[model samples]
Target: MVLSAKTKQSGVTSTTNMDKPNNSKRPLSHATDSTRTSESCDVLVLSNKMMTNLTSEFLTEQTTQPDVISKVLLERNKLKDLPFELVDFINLEVINLSYNCFHQFPSVICEMLSLREIIMVGCEIEALPSNFDQLSGLETIILDLNHLRKIGDTLCTLNKLTTLSLGMNYFSVFYSTLPDQITKLNLDNNHLAVFPDCILALANLRQLNLSFNRIKELPVEIDGLTELEELLIVKNRLHALPSTICNLV
Candidate 1:
């Protein structure tokens, strides 16, 4: 359930199985050229190593060449800062750095012009970069279980984004204007007290989750979601059903 990727580099798009048995405990710097076999493909799988300890020579030796690696899986490695050499992978399309120690959204990610998806769940991220909208090719972003207290307005500028998950964060209000193409939105387990009026703008939304919040009433505007097929608002403090909800059918 971590991040995965498909790369046009190496003319190969493969998924790295994090479940693979780690038979090599050798330091990444000592990994022989033989380890870069077809079995590893384009994935540089590290087993529970602290990324901060990796030397630039070790990284360069592992990748051999920047264009040879199109996908990088650094999840669960307790990464605090992105490797400075990662920008060399000019064709990178996906990045999954979940379950790490990141406290702020890495600004270095914006430099990957080819990135299509970013998964960073269970981090301490408090805010995204101001120019995050420059990632025009990004299509999916998952930032669940972070420390975010509010959605950024720049999020609406990613015209290609279709899925966004912000569940289990510290959000008290929903004020950002999401792109119209977003089909799935997760805002579960936040501190919201009232329904966000911005939800009405997602005309193409098909699924929405607002569970485990402090909302007290359903807005009559809920009927504006004509394309919605699944709505989850359980665990709120609703006293009565809004009659306008009948218009959903």
Candidate 2:
């Protein structure tokens, strides 16, 4: 697989080329786009060696317009200008913009129609779009080490989400509802004291970590999670874990 960047006056567009493996002549179906009229490459796949050298060069040349690319991994880049306008391209499935300097909420992110996993950890984001719940297809959201104060009510609409991490954030608000689809949860090193009983609604959760928080007691209904496999509350101010917790394991 080879990465090629095409630059226009607006920015850069990337194309991934695959050298034919001698044995297999089958065509690879990168994502399809209905509105794209001209010849275009919608997906790019690169090996570890190619990704290490060209990821930054590919992104730096982007044209600041809607991209046809479906998946972008730009972690640990010195990225300052996150093209919010590019979010209108709903074809993106996975984006890794971690370790950048993005501040405040990025509203355009909510418009990505196919985005499934977003890893924007340590971006310094303080809030999210108000209609953030509209991202119905999102499955994994990693916002660890940001400056978020509260999770918007729209969070309950991400029914496909399986893993969530808000560790090291400044979450001051209380959560009254959590999506039932969540299977892995991490709230380590936050400022939460207690959450509403509605937390027990996640009956399918398998791993839950609330270590390093200021929580004092467990909500009695928490034992209702019969599928829970690991529950870690190592550094919280718990007097005693509910006997129900022992029953789950």
Best by TM-score: 1
Off by more than 4 A, model 2: 1-68
The residue-level lDDT of candidate 1 at 16 comes to 32
What ranges in model 1 sit over 4 Å off? 1-40
Please report the candidate that would top lDDT against the real structure: 1
Q: TM-scores of the models, in the given order? A: 0.80, 0.71
Clashes found in each candidate (C-alpha, N, C closer than 3 A):
0, 4
- All models: lDDT? 0.71, 0.63
Worst 10 residues of 2 by lDDT: 23-32
C-alpha root-mean-square deviation, candidate 1: 13.0
C-alpha lDDT of candidate 1 relative to the true structure: 0.71
The number of residue pairs in model 1 that clash at the backbone is 0
